[model samples]
Target: MTKFLKTSLGLVAATSLLFSCNEFKVTQETDGSKFQIHEKGDGKTTAKEGDIVTFDLVIKAPNDTVFTDTYKRKEPIVMPVQKGAFKGSFDNALTHLSAGDSATVYVSADSLFMRVQQPLPPGVTKGSDMKFIVKIKSIQTMAEFQKAQEEKKNNEAKVMENYAQKNFPNATKTQYGMYRVVLKEGSGATITAGKSVKVDYTGKLINGTTFDSSVGREPIEFSVGQGAVIPGWEQALMMMKKGEKSIFFIPSNLAYGEQGSGPIPPFSPLIFEMEVIDVK
Candidate 1:
């Protein structure tokens, strides 16, 4: 189910048994859990709670319908292990795996959908098995993963700084840390909190890829300072006057932060070219 894509519990993998690449093996434990290992690792490595693991996972239902696949999403699932957060046999199978290991853990479709509070689809029944093919890529302590994450954020910030300096030489940073460049000044009323305003705008990422726009459609109207938009738009719009045109370089903290919205990846900086069409 698509709900699995947005859940923290779905990131966990359960541990089970061992098998060889040359032969297919299926084992059903006394507890009614089943698993099949396609390829075994060297067995020198293992993971536990609080450790971070990176892996590619694909969930398949009957008829070869894929529920979700991290490989096709272009982003492998990297997450901290939190046991008992989810109610399923899948994660129990992960404890037996190490880096370079791959396996298919099976769970009853009824158990999974019931845990997520969803009804099973037509092709799946109560006792039907939902298969998860998981390939463990890497494992690290939480401290190591945190350090890597911080380094990644710093690198992205540096890239944004270089781009802003090279392309917007005259841009001024605001007191709240937003970089701004006014293109056209207006003599109309100043925009303020609680004021209703209408604007046409184009939004892009740091790479100049446009993600959204109001230019070809109707201008959007919203009340200022009402949390009606992203923090970037709310802050930048307050600095503009009616009919003013400006370009803003918003950091991730003021845009989407680490948990990005649709089409926007985590820790992404954004660009916006906007015109304040009216203030009411």
Candidate 2:
């Protein structure tokens, strides 16, 4: 995740440099000190097949008023720029870019959706010219990236077991390696053998350290059979019905197998005190 953060940060920082640098239109003979792209790149700029990309993009009008910038987001937006994900100039500009390339294109105001609160202020056409600079960062080959990341996280969940042990001094066992001292059941969720359901839950390592919990602000809604909840959650919750509450001490393999996220280390056990808030 930090790596992803760094890549986004780098993309945003690139835009800041534009303030002091000269704009370069697309050309082969352009100086190498800074990148100058005129016509959009002739490759796949829109992310496809799980590619992660970072780029410095600029939007402008014929009058040169800047409209939007990803730099303001402070993080390079990450997403697969697929068909229908973006329309108009944003989509058109990306249609011609590939990994690590940049481009500047003129998008008609009509295509890019430029808005004016007041009257057109004289001669601005409804489909006036809009300018933009774009760059492509990195690309992944498949959606397996999410799964790979999850596996890496599972490998890191080991440190969480100690957290549960330290905190759940009196936690009792339920079914499928789950445990908790009962709180108000409050009418939990109902589950069939092969149905999807949502749940509110929290998890901690054995050392009383809490790893994660959705019990604070709002109840979490997720499908039971879908990979939405962890394996342990599905296993434990399957034994429960509406209004059921239990304490669950999940083994590492059942939780995050090896990799951890933010705080939990690899191969961690989790103890959850859960109340089935709702089910569907």
- C-alpha lDDT (0 to 100) for residue 222 of candidate 2: 69
Query: Which residue runs does candidate 1 get wrong by more than 4 Å?
Result: 1-45, 54-58, 69-78, 84-88, 96-105, 133-138, 152-157, 166-170, 181-187, 199-220, 241-246, 256-268, 273-278
lDDT of 2 by residue, 205-224 (tens): 65566656776668776667
In terms of TM-score, the best-performing candidate is 1
> How far does residue 24 in candidate 1 sit from its true spot (Å)?
6.7
Tell me, by lDDT, which candidate is best.
1
lDDT score, residue 13, model 2? Answer: 86
User: Native-vs-model 2 lDDT?
Assistant: 0.58
TM-score of 1: 0.65
Taking all chains together, each candidate's TM-score versus the true structure is 0.65, 0.37
Task: Report lDDT (CA) for all predictions.
Answer: 0.80, 0.58
Per-residue alpha-carbon lDDT of candidate 1 for residues 30-98, written as tens digits (9 for 90 to 100):
545477878877667787777888888999986567888977665578777666434456765666668
- lDDT score, residue 226, model 2? 68
